[model samples]
Target: MNRDDGPLFGGRAWLPALLIVPMFLGFAFLGVQGGTVIGTLTLAAVVVWAIRANPEGPIEIAAPGEGVRGGVLVVLLAPIDDPPVAGVLAAITDPSRREAGEPLLLAPTRIGRLDRFFGDIEAARFESQRVLAVSVATLAAAGIEVEGRVGDDDVVLAAEDTLRTYAATEVVVFAPGEDDDGAIAKLERRLGIPLRRID
Candidate 1:
């Protein structure tokens, strides 16, 4: 879900109510047989719409051509100090060819379910900022320049949002562990651009 669209049914609370009101009206006016049919059909429609609007679904991204010189977008899934930063640096900068500009480091806010429900994301944002700070400082100390920004809670959504403004030829994800194979595969299929994962 793009931030602009808000959370599922966030601002558009009226939509579900609108669909539900007709069912009760049918129950009051029509016979049980007719009301049951209407209610079932309405429920089915809602289910279909929800599935279609799912944020986990693949997003459309432009593929960069091979050997193109462009910016790199680095997504940091965990805070890194030194050891992991070396791997991240290796993934973003190729010894064979020079990249276009400073890599953009994005850290997604990882909020808990309860925090998200209550719209209290300050802690999550702070954590993400800290991740970016540590990663950026580590990279800088290693003599590599980077730009950092906090992203959306969902990694895919964060990457998609970054790509809108950053002309990235490749994307590098710094996952905490090798267990993120499923997420890496999903990103590879959806991002379209070249992707490298460092765990």
Candidate 2:
């Protein structure tokens, strides 16, 4: 963010309540009483769990204490705001090309089938697919492996969950544009694991 933007946003604390008001009002005003009560309670509980579970800043994980040969280095590539799954696919196929060879693992974190179908139409899909295909032919050119998955409640939360599950030693990231700090901060908090932001 530009230094001139000041504190970025105000009332960061009440922001959730403000956003949820519409949902609350809509449920209450257009009631089917029993269903509304159950749904509202469920929504509120999830919101609380999600917020309480995330971290809140940029992370810088230390190098692994174990031998490099035995350690597992993971990179959680967040989805592109522009919605091109290919970079993700390509990155997963080979992340070592980036910043001193960060042993890339393309984390699958995206919407359901509807989004994937729509994705096939994007030009980025072609570019990513092209890069992915070529990268396969030239695995010796760069050592990278990619695997995909979907249905991470939140990519950040899912990434964090994976980290703990895998006991990852270090994490690498592909940040979207220049100064996308808020999104970065949200991930840091959600994952609670520090990360190194890669270009």
Candidate 3:
């Protein structure tokens, strides 16, 4: 969902009406048959529209407080933009990393979509950056030592790049959904580092 998309059907109140009009007209014309076809088409249209319109689901990540230095790397996924996730950021981050004024790098990855083709790349990338920016700000406000944050569309590529760039002792993943496990596991195997998730 791009910032330009304007808040989930924002100004487009007529879309549902547009769908309903045909069904009503069909019912008036050919009685049951026409109404059924239009009704089916309308249902399909609504499903497609909903899939395209709705935003990503929330992924909540929280962990108990642990104090350590700058040896842990954090990779954030969706729902990190939510303010409540900030407490998790504070928990996983090492207070010493902030106290020593060290710049902790947090990589935010937005999953790519098969629906977004070449022409749609710019808008998609912009939306991804927008989401990542919010997550970064949320983490920063929690006093996490995130000096700089990186954004990527592919989760595995981002994890590989993060591992290559940072000499982190361990890894923490902030993903809170069952469907994400396979992707997270792929990253874990590629990095060859133990990836801990907040249950």
Please report the candidate that would top lDDT against the real structure. 1
Give the per-residue lDDT digits (tens) of candidate 2, residues 1-199: 3433223223255555555665667667766775477667767875776666533433333344454321233333443333233344345434454332334343434344675677543443444444334434343333334332332425465554454434444455555455333544566554534456654
Against the true structure, what is each candidate's TM-score? 0.69, 0.37, 0.51
What is the TM-score of candidate 3? 0.51
lDDT, candidates in the order shown: 0.75, 0.45, 0.59
TM-score of 2: 0.37
Candidate 1 colliding pairs: none
Q: List RMSD in Å for every model shown.
A: 6.9, 12.2, 15.8
List model 3 lDDT by residue over 82-187, tens digit each: 5666786576565655422233445454534654444356665555566557666777777664654655666666655555545555577777677454767766
Q: How well is each residue in 17-80 modelled by candidate 1, as lDDT tens digits? A: 6887878888889978878989999999878877776555445443445543247788888877
Ranked by TM-score, the better of candidates 1 and 3 is 1
Top candidate by TM-score: 1
Candidate 2: count of backbone clashes, pairs at least 3 residues apart or interchain: 5
